[model samples]
Target: MTIQATNLGFPRIGARRELKKATEGYWSGRLEDGELKDIGRELRKRHWSLQAECGLDVIPSNDFSYYDQVLDMIAMLGAIPERFADIGDGKDLTTYFAMARGTDQAPAMEMTKWFDTNYHYIVPEFCHDQHFSLSSSKAIDEFLEARELGIHTRPVLIGPVSFLLLGKLRDEPCRPLDLLQRLLPVYRELLQRLVAAGADWVQIDEPFLAMDLDESARDAFQQAYDGLAGSGVRLLLATYFEGLRDNRHLACRLPVAGLHLDRIRGNDHLDELAAELHPDQTVSLGVVDGRNIWRSDLDATLELLEQARELLGQRPLQIAPSCSLLHVPVDLSLERHLDDELAAMLAFGRQKLEEISALARALNGQGDQARSTFEDSRRTLHARSSSDRIHNTAVAQRLAAVGPDDVVRDSSYPVRRKVQQAHLNLPGFPTTTIGSLPQTMEVRRTRAAWRRGDIDDATYRSFIERQIDHAIEFQERIGLDVLVHGEFERNDMVEYFGEKLEGFAFTDNGWVQSYGSRCVKPPIIFGDVRRPEAMTTQWLRYAQSCTRRPVKAMLTGPVTMLQWSFVRDDQPRSDTCQQIALALRDEVADLESAGARAIQVDEPALREGLPLRRADHDDYLDWATCSFRLATSVAGNSTQIHTHMCYSEFNDIMPAIAALDADVISIEASRSAMELLDAFVDFDYPNEIGPGIWDIHSPRVPSSEAMTRLLERAASVIDRDRLWVNPDCGLKTRDWPEVEQALTHLVAAARTMRESTSQRHSA
Candidate 1:
């Protein structure tokens, strides 16, 4: 038996990002239902045809989504919440989008982090009395749609266990797994429909199995598969992100026909897994890297597959990616602006598909075809691996020269706090904002005009400076201690810097959706990463010159800059991150030299970069935290280094946050009602902290009393003097009126805190 090619998933954002444009247009009343459906059909056809072209033996259907897969699962199981059901059955496209992104009249279900990725999924809400049935048949419909195009495909679904695990109970304590006995019927019905539709194989993804699971959760997995085992379709139980360590015995005992393991991230499990595979079960080895832009080392991958083949002689082997291609960009070939040599060193979603196919062909003895592509890939890899452009000898020497003492300042936190307090003395309780103010429609229009040459550089710069001046003057009037220039000129914190750096390339339309109606166009780092000149010096200097109040020089930290962008595949990520850190190190020195007293390097994506498995988190955090220190450690004792993180649950990563050694950290805590402060209390963290006083996700301005109550909660765990009051995140998404109103109450709350503290001390 030979290895067959398969894909865990492919990019759903159409080649032209037609879905993004169509969804936005439909929401804005610019597109008809017919137009949107046509685009969807075309995207599915293109995706299927491309997979077929890559010679994939098991091409996946039901993976193309207008929004997200988790939402699709909610529709498939007919688990529509009561509020959403009023919009009518799932067939109505308008109602579907309304559920995904609420209308003017209806508030959408809360969207939250999707397993640490920037991509957000609509959280499924289940009431205590919830019942399940097959509500929508999207899986069957998409499978049929692909069959009509003459491509027989295996349908993909988020497994019952993972679906229930990822979802939340609406104001109830019942675990979703508690409903497994009832939910089994809906999944069975969906499977039977696919089986009737002539699907021979079905892929059910249960990624949560890679995480730490209790005995009950493990038992539920076995129980869920027992019902699905007899469904006629051959079941492929896919687990990615990391290997099944503690759960390996349970996985081996499952009744599923095959198991898919991510070898890229879980390479350590290869030998162990080979010895544990059931005699009758098939093995799908995910040797291709999915989350990164790196090119595969074909020789190494082939050898691993070959070893697996030897261990499980007659068992069928399937080659695939470690996870979905949703985390990566589409088509490296679309990058026309990148230099040819650098472009050859990278692989996007489409190229990854080809890698899977090539590996399969090589294993099947079509050695010549495989050899041709392998040699080409190797040539590109070797050339980039040793290229003079990528290696800055001076930078590498500086990294070697760095001592342990370099990461630490001259004095400890106690001494530095005293110096900082005296330098910026103002009030007992201080109020400031996380960098950006707002990116209004006018600012977007001006940037667009300048890009099209409709406006000159001088005109654009003058407009941005005016916005900054207004932001500064407004903050002063509202009695803010520290102020921001509002980041008016930046398209994105990282993209703007990436555009100015030497080793990066930008696309006109490389937009990837970060959350509901918010998209980020991540720049492609195509060569050795180095800042040829200062990326943010001019705007930062200009803003500092205008404000008498201490204006924090903002820079996206090294780890975050790498995490958010399409990084170069030539070097190890740790090495590439260090390159970015050194570049920022120079900029940090410049910011301090230019009379700036504080600098906030935002690493919002740091937690997102952690490996899915608990065992791997420590090593990942080590490099990630080290990169942050390398970026900010250049500052002198008086320069207060601040870092901002948004929408992150920091309880688990508290030690890593503290290790960054920033003078102050402002985190998104208002939504959690200062629940994150519990970690600080338990750990006795000594650094200054800011738990957000108000949630900025909504337009409603929080009352001063509300803000005061939140600050009081923070004060219980953190020292009052060490607390800084701020919003949950940046104000780019909000309007000026909302920003002004929110900060007004924020300032008032700090005033109340100071007065209460004075009375308490006097008493």
Candidate 2:
């Protein structure tokens, strides 16, 4: 076997979040343009060097991004939307960031989760008369840049077909796929340049292949690769985040020199691939998991490869991590504080790359030479299963005792709706802010000081109290029906809950990119989860003390916590989630006792946690929704239950979402406007719905008239009594001015609609 090693993609944010800081600094005018680009260049050079040092045969270039790769592709193709293009052709990074973040005058383009991952992508907008041109040479430039460093790298591109399919039709009379031929020329030109620049191979990612493709998408894949067939560049057609499954025949027929399969995610399809793969083409077998933090079982991976070798021979094999390391934290070795046992079981991006290299050596007739590394991996795997931290009998007993009644609310939504309406005295179109207010620079500064012990507990508590007081005053002045405590005392929602719970560990410097220049440190759940005490009751009580309106108690849902954290692999994820839910159910009971009539449990990650394959979905949705119901069922019918979902395609999961049984579910709909609402309305969603009226992701404050227009559309589908108004998501990322302006408009819009509805009823 002459197997090689490669990576589909690596994390772009620096191991210590250098890119995040540099990018944010540039946006804030704290750094010059040249300095920002230099930081990006430095990060790329360091990543490429690290991958090369690990003895990988092929490293990926152009995976690095200041904002998003899809957005970069848009700029590269001169497909800049007219809103951002009015400033310039997006030839410079300024226009690029402007398109992503928006200028003071124009709002940024729509951004949503990238294929169910937390990573966000800027949505491309196509007009009816859209045409394409080769505007940027980033792919060629990056390949040449790597070559100059004495390193040969395969440049990665978002495949032409997937790119068009990923886009939404905005001003177009037709879908984006209608312009495939026009877009093909730009890709062809880029490929020709890469081939001219001494590139032998290029990785064109077609992740959309994993989705249920219609005939048109399948045909476009054939046309695209067939169009670029004559180009001298050898193509590695990559698919990850899921398996080809039904699309395996299409994969074999695509005219590419190579095929990459995610063995971790697509383990079931390996036999089919072994039978269908063409003898002439090479296959890159992704044996390690790039999306997780667990160490790979090298012996097991090699076993799978040995079988593949029997079918296709070692001459055609290449090893890699499934999908990209973009989802995991960058480096595990940097954590000097991690316990030895925990550290051994964990593998971040850097460690995962080394695992890929080790697997290659063992498979390449050097098993004896790599014996020590293999034994260590075996030990890590064994230690995780046998560790005392893996189980708690009490947790198991509690789970065993959970009856059907434990996973269902006390009453139906219609009954709860009448009880909630009578108890709360809310207006027809209720106005509320989502669970958080802006966490300003001073809030962050004080938090840092408190963590460092520069400020004592008393001091920190007082500081947070002041912040909450201010937030309550602001909400009252703005006339919001329900208010949050601003979440000033907490850091990340999941992280805060994890810190208070047993068997969860915190990282000091584990910053992972949430989006462009935005980062989050997901907690590490290493053992059995149990709450130490009430997580939100104190804050909920404090915020309610200052206001007569119902103070919303905010809690992160079990699925969101489980999905976001580095969970244990020793047990089924649904088991771990149920354990977390049992703990949260206690907290929910506490908050209700503390007089919080409106509790908003944010499950932004539920839709994201769904298994990528639809065949495996029912099993997941069954447990995921059950866990959520278990957490929130403790609340009485008089209390309003609100759950928020962030940017996601929730149409498929509407039934499961309805299963959550939240009295009110506030979803992100501003970007799609009233389009997402059509689903809820069409389904005759039994619960009250808050279709977001403002795009909180963008800093641009929406006008009352614009928000009222969205609410008007919402009312046309949903009953006026059932419609609640709010921003798309939390306001923690926005500044005070932005949040204040946006919420004012949101409140005004709700009030205007309420008056109009009253007029109709009176008439």
Candidate 3:
């Protein structure tokens, strides 16, 4: 039997992010649904062609999503939320995008990092009385459409167990897993339907198997696949992101004809699979690295494949990426401007496919035949080490000299808290904005015009200063205690800082999706990082000049900057992060020297960057927390160091969160109605926290009463002195009107909270 080369999934954003443009156009009423649908079709055809041309076997269909695949699964299963049921039953772009991005009438569901990766999925919402029907046949139609183009592909589906496991059940004692029995028939029917549509193999993703699962979740998996049996379509049970550590035995015993293992992440699981897997089961060995942009070491991968082949003998093994290529950029070939050495070390989706194809060829008795490819991979590995562009002796010497004292404040938290409280003279539950005002279309227009040479630096600076003045005036009118410079002159938090720092390079348009309708062009970090000069000191100084209230010296934390960028793989990630930390240290000192009293260094990506396997998280948190301290430790006790983290459950990382030792931390909690604050309460958190009083992801303007209610709920658990009032995250994605209304109520809510607290104290 020939070894099949397969991809679990591919990027759906198209080569130029045509889907983003089309979707945004449709949302703005500039493009009709017909135009948007046409773009989707063209994008799908192009992607399928690219995969086929790369010589891949078992390509995927139904992985293409206008928003998210899980949301698509939600639509396919007729699991529409109660509020959006009025949109009618169809895979209409209006209803789909509305669910992902909220309308004026309804709030969007929560979005968080999918597994351990940067890609965000709209969290599925399931009620206690959840029911299912096959409301959409886009999956089957897409599978047949690929056949029309002569590419017979496996239709992929998010398995029922994993879907409900990732969902949230509201106002109901029934957990999502309890509804699994009812949810299985929907999948069984979908599998049979795909088979009828001429798909012989269906790839059902159950990545939750890679996570720590309870007994109920494990049992649900058995019940799911058992129910899915006899559906006539051969199932390729796929899991990625990490290993099946404790779930290895359960995975082996599942009654499926084929199983796909992520060899890159769970390389240790081969022996377990060999011992426990049924001999008749086909094994799809995922050897290529999928979550990152680094080129695979083909020489090493070939050796691993040889071992796997010897172990699984005639079980019809297939070659594939460890997971989908959705997390990385679409193609490396699209890049026009990268230093030759870094380019050689990189592999986006297009290059990963080539590597997978080469791996498959080498295993099929073509080792000598792919000599050129192996030589190139080996050469890049050597060249990167010796390349002068990658290392700096001075930077290395500096890191070697850093002692533990460089990462800690001289005073303890209690001493520092007393000094900070006396210096700032702030009231209980002080209110502040999360470092940005709305980046309106006019602001973007001015920026785009400036970049295109329609205007000069003087004109741009003048416009930004005026905008900052307006922001300061608005904050003063709203009675906000701590003000921000509005971040109008910046594009992205990390990218804006990265452009000014040494040892970094950027693309003209290297856009990658952060979520639905939200794309970020992450700056690429190369060589030894350093800050030749301050990134935000001048802006912070200027904004402070406009206000008597202290304007925060806002900056992105070192761990976050490193996590968000396309970092170098030649060295340890911790080492690169340390270099970044040292650079940010210089910037922090500059801001302190520039008369900035409050500095908010945001590390929103901190929790998202933790290892998938809990066993590996300690080493990561050590360096990550150390780096954060290294960046912010230079400030005096009077200089309040504030940091912000957004999304993902922080309950697991609360110890690390406490270790960072920032004077204050603002986290995303309002979207869950402050459910996330229980971790702080349980930990007996010492520092101040702003549990984001309202959800910034939605367009709906929250009322002052709602904000007060959330504050009261948070106050029930947290000491009032320890709670700071803020929004869920930055308001950059919002419009001026929405931001204006939100902040106005936010200030009123803070005042109301303070008054009530004082009244209770007096009584």
Maximum-lDDT candidate: 2
TM-score of each: 0.90, 0.97, 0.96
lDDT of 2 at 373: 73
Candidate 1 regions exceeding 4 Å error are 32-37, 78-112, 125-131, 168-176, 268-275, 367-372, 445-459, 502-511, 524-528, 568-572, 671-674, 693-720, 741-763
lDDT string, candidate 2, 156-256, tens digits: 99999889887887864688898899999889999999999999999999998887888999999999999999888899999998888889999988889
User: In angstroms, how far off is 27's CA in candidate 3?
Assistant: 1.1
List model 1 lDDT by residue over 1-763, tens digit each.
7779999888788656778888778766898988988888898999999989988998999888778788888877877777766786766776677677654455455556677577777667777777998988889999999999999998999999999888778667788888888899889899999999999889999998888898889889999999888888899999988878788888888898899998876754656766777777888988888877768888878888888888777888999999888777778777766667766777788889999999999999987877877987789778877787766677677767877766666678788888988887758778889998889889999998998899999999999999988988999999999888889888899998887776777765566667654677788776667777776777778888887789888999988888888876556788778778888988999888887788999998888888787777898899889889888888888888999987656788888999998999999887556768879767877798888887776545778998999999889888898888899889987888878888999999999999999999999
What are the candidates' C-alpha RMSDs? 3.3, 1.6, 2.0
Which lDDT tens digits does candidate 3 get at residues 1-763?
6777889999888768899999989888999989998999889999999999887977999989988888999889988888897765546877887788776677787788887666788888888888888889989989988899998999999988889988989869889999988888888888888888888899999999888887888889999988888899889999997878888899899888888888777855576678888877889888888777777788888888888888886788889999988877888777887767778888888888888888887877766756777888999888877888778899999999999899998798899999988888888889897888899989999998997899999999899999999999998988889899899988999999898887887765567778886777778887789888778887788889987788888999998899889887778989999999999999889999998989999998899889887779999999999999998899999999999988787888998998999999998887666778668667888889999987888777889999999999889988898889999899898888878888989989998999999999999
Considering every candidate listed, which one attains the maximal TM-score? 2
Model 2 global lDDT (CA atoms, 0 to 1)? 0.87
In order of TM-score, best first, we have: 2, 3, 1
Instruction: Give Cα-based local distance difference scores for all models.
Output: 0.83, 0.87, 0.86
Clashing pairs in 1: none
